[model samples]
Target: MKSHLPEKIYLASPVWLQNVLVSTYGAFEHRRRYSGPHKKYVEYLRKNVFLNKTEIADLQSKLLERTLKHAAQTVPAYQALNLGPTPKLTDFPLLERESIAMNAEAFLSSKYKKEKLITLFTGGSSASPLKIYISEEARQKSYSFWQLFYDRMDFHVGDRKATLVGRKIQEPDSNNPPFWRYNLKDRQLLFSSYHLSEKNVAAYLKKLNSFQPKIIEGYPLSIYRLADQIIQNSIKLSFTPTGVSTSSENFTQKQREIIEEAFGCKVFDQYGSAESVVFASECEHGNMHIEPEYGVLEVLTNEGKIESEGSGELIATSLLNEAMPLIRYRIGDLGEITESNCPCGRASKILTELYGKVGAVIINEGRQAPTAAIAIAFEYLEGIKNAQIIQNEPGKVTVRLVKRTNFDSKSEEFMIWELKKMLGQSLKISIDYVTEIPPEHNGKYCMVVQNYYKFTVPD
Candidate 1:
């Protein structure tokens, strides 16, 4: 295991500082025997989080006899290694993040405590920031999902993934090369989500045109925006991307449609967490599937059952990443089950409709989608580099534009009429002119946020 002292959890610098995150975990040791009450807790967790009734029953029978035996032989926190004359497993106790943050050194396994281990930190947007402590074995096993999932999609790690994000805003200069790639188990090219301007996009496009990656991943809206530019420039998206993926935020159908036109590829939406846990992933058939191999999905319903589709809470219990197991963890996202199965041969569960990420559903009024008439009208506008329309409330909308100063009132009138012809007369438009738009709460910029969407956490 690696030390947090040399990590970048504490600063904005190239290095990770230890203080930014601290979470104590149940400690383990190699070449050790457990003799205390470890069996009881492990059995309870296995039954509640990992097994079904039959499996639990079968496990219980074995556990009935070996609970003491297993604990005495394996778990370190136990009191007696083999019920020895005097054991102190009770002294260690159940581990947690708080304790780890207090004493990181004592928890490390003696075998590899001095070895070099790759490290990482959590984004902390879901609940609270956590300092993740892992071993080379832990890191590889914990992060093996994407690699396997992609291989399932027939794409290899050496291929490039198109990333559309809205994090850092970088103004162009030859000093820092606009493109960067890293060896994160697989190859990657880091592009700036901050510089998607008309000129910047054209330049970004030219660069991508040369790199010619085989896949795309990142923000949905940014990819959609790039698609708008591609259409305007008469750019051919015939480049065969193995697949297009999106995450870190909610994806609107409108944005997905745009990405399809721009990338000329199917979009795969993946849902995950810093817990290094897998939630759900989209299949080739445009259907989202859960990797139950990694965790169990529990949909908590309300009293109504009236709004029926099993919509309420999405709670999950991870299956594989056991370095630190989270039991019945609340994801805080609202969703429902879809009875339909994908034409693809994937054997996984499905969800019907998903309202954006975590508490985003809100009541509001605003322009919805462009009618076939508006899409037709877009053909007439000139100097129109790219655009995004967000309905804030019942009668208000925000328009993000990247165009030349030559856009006069006459042009505005034409654009307004086209919008009116499409969204109908009930909605009003609010144009916010800025060099570029910034990402929302997370590092992702969702194209649409229900004008007044509000989410409440239960007390």
Candidate 2:
């Protein structure tokens, strides 16, 4: 969010020039992520996966000690705690998002200057974005985990990949054909989630056939919409990926089924946060395994007691990021960690179930829509600060929005039009422009709140 091109400049550039800019940015990212320590880190993870339970625990303890020592010595926020020469993870109090946002500078290490670190802004979940900083080494280490996961799925970095995530390659309101851009350096084709309507999907499919990417990675709902269309029309894809990978949103079994059926391959769903504190990837055996090498994950109950094998909120400590080290940070997501071991021969912990932002389903009469679909409705819309969708009854919905000073009738009209294209014409949609959309009781934002069940029972 912090490093994106200005809207005026992006719109003013010609299509070819836009591709050039995208490729150039992609090349920079490729060099930053894949150089130096990346390969070594990936190799370490490859062998670390097979480590036994006791071995992993020992590795995590050492990593935790190192991270805590670095933070207590260098970070001003942790220094105030007076954590002694040897302190446990719980010695530091649980960190809240407000604590980070209010004193962001205080959290930074004294050794690193703000201008020197790579600053990243988280998107899609909160009304206010949280800025996180890290060194290039930490950034590359974080990316290595993802590359290792992709390797498990038979896809590697620099391979031809078609990404259906939220990238503003094209205008939100445009109805034209090319709703995607090519990053030649990374061998990636970035597609805009805004223009994935029925009218434009054929063109998208045509392009996919020609590009023939080996792997497709994106939000599950965005990919699901394409798979749903393929199934509905009984259309066969001209190409098949080695496998499909999904992240950035909660994935459902139904969505996985449709995607796999359409693509004729397995669907691997991975869970991670932009905060870089925790990561979990699905194995070929279809189990979600939490890599102990990345960080220490603790599932805790409402009373702050750790849950050994059941459902609770996830608390994690990052072993990677020292620039702004977060120890025992409340990740604001819920999940069930089971004691059951994965048959895939990995000793990493298994997450039996995980939920982020609830992934609530909005029902319009008989048709159901995921929250990710609703969020994509506002993609590339410049004037919108935040938006939320609420469905109280079937076939009726209300959208609450926080708009910027430049928000106009055109922005609202395009949003409504996009919503209609996805939900249906029968969906009675209403827009309410407000100052802010507050977070829920758990301090996390829900993109879609479904009260349809409270209003009436299903058929």
Candidate 3:
């Protein structure tokens, strides 16, 4: 019998893992992460050595100075930022997409030449296209924490693993070994997230069962969708994962419930982006704990004030990176600073809830959220592949679907009846079948798009 695992683990692994490995290696030079050096480092990190607000400000003081020193020598952008010495965090130049596009090298620090940087190509999650170079130390720091974060989450480095994630569309050369990371001693099944057509999902599932990874991570939407298909087929599975983590996209309540039901593990929801920082992760009880060790996050209101003590727009500063520091960088997402602390007793700030990305469209009418509740009806309906609620006009909605089979009248009526029960019958509902559902220009999976910004209220 094969084991079943969700297909989106790679996106969440970077930040947490980067912190883990660096912290561990620093503590003990020659120890395996699960045992000697790694264990001690995890203990020290979890208990001691986290920077608070004042401490972060102090670190930023030195970091900004170092960054300025580097930029003046290497980065053209900063010399051009043309600030006087002793620039405050706000004083540091803001490198939005426009600034980079205008003059890419202008952002480079003067200290290090462009050739010195180990460049990492960044496919901007937003519409922008450009490659950003990160310093070697910054790159190491970016990946260092994986072992440490896993230790924090109880995943030891020595533990064998399988990673189901998005990979290069072309299959690896057959002559090469099946496992890609040759240096890493542990075993892994590196399956491609893109090749998950229904025809091949079973094959992937079978391979995952054989690999039996202790931890599985990936984007939320794709993982849940694959799990839904696996569960629908009623294939017997024995996937006893210690943890399942999600990243790159928002994890809705509906998706969480379905993921748990399908995989039988807690969903460790991770938040952040590829270019900058790894902000938070869900504890056992579902509260989000931000990575206060390396980054500081602030919540600003729609009016651009820091109003959401717990939830608001996230304006973050990455304290760890001196390579290309993102000082008070605005990564668009709505959230609040949570007053509620977790029962687990970690003192890290809890990010109560994240309302997806700026691209996410939550269904609502007036001040009330009818679309929010209706969206929950899509937990894990067997045989129903994927569903998206799109509103083209007022009072009229379209339920676009990517189906596994043609919906008979009875099945369609049942779905409509369930939707009505959730979204109110007064709202006109139309169902459409398509070979594929298109994403918003930003390459984000938008579950709903209401052009008029008005939706039906649930009676």
Give all TM-scores, in the order shown: 0.53, 0.84, 0.61
Question: Looking at candidate 2, what is the lDDT of residue 144?
Answer: 90
Per-residue lDDT tens digits of candidate 1, residues 146-262?
Answer: 554464456754566555543221222212335333323234555654344455566667767777888877766556657778866788643667677777666567667767767
* Candidate scoring better on lDDT of 1 and 3: 3
Task: Summarize candidate 3's per-residue lDDT along 90-193 as a digit string, tens digits.
Answer: 56543454454345566555555678875543322232223455665555554445554565457865465655543321222212222222114444444444
Look at candidate 3 and tell me the lDDT of residue 1: 8
lDDT of the candidates, in the order given: 0.47, 0.77, 0.53
Model 3 weakest 10-residue run by lDDT: 1-10
Per-residue lDDT tens digits for candidate 2, residues 116-164, read 8987755345433356888888889988999888987688887899998
TM-score of 1: 0.53
lDDT of 1 at 60: 38
Which of candidates 1 and 2 reaches a greater TM-score?
2
Candidate 3 wrong stretches, greater than 4 Å? 1-44, 47-85, 92-95, 169-186, 306-311, 357-459
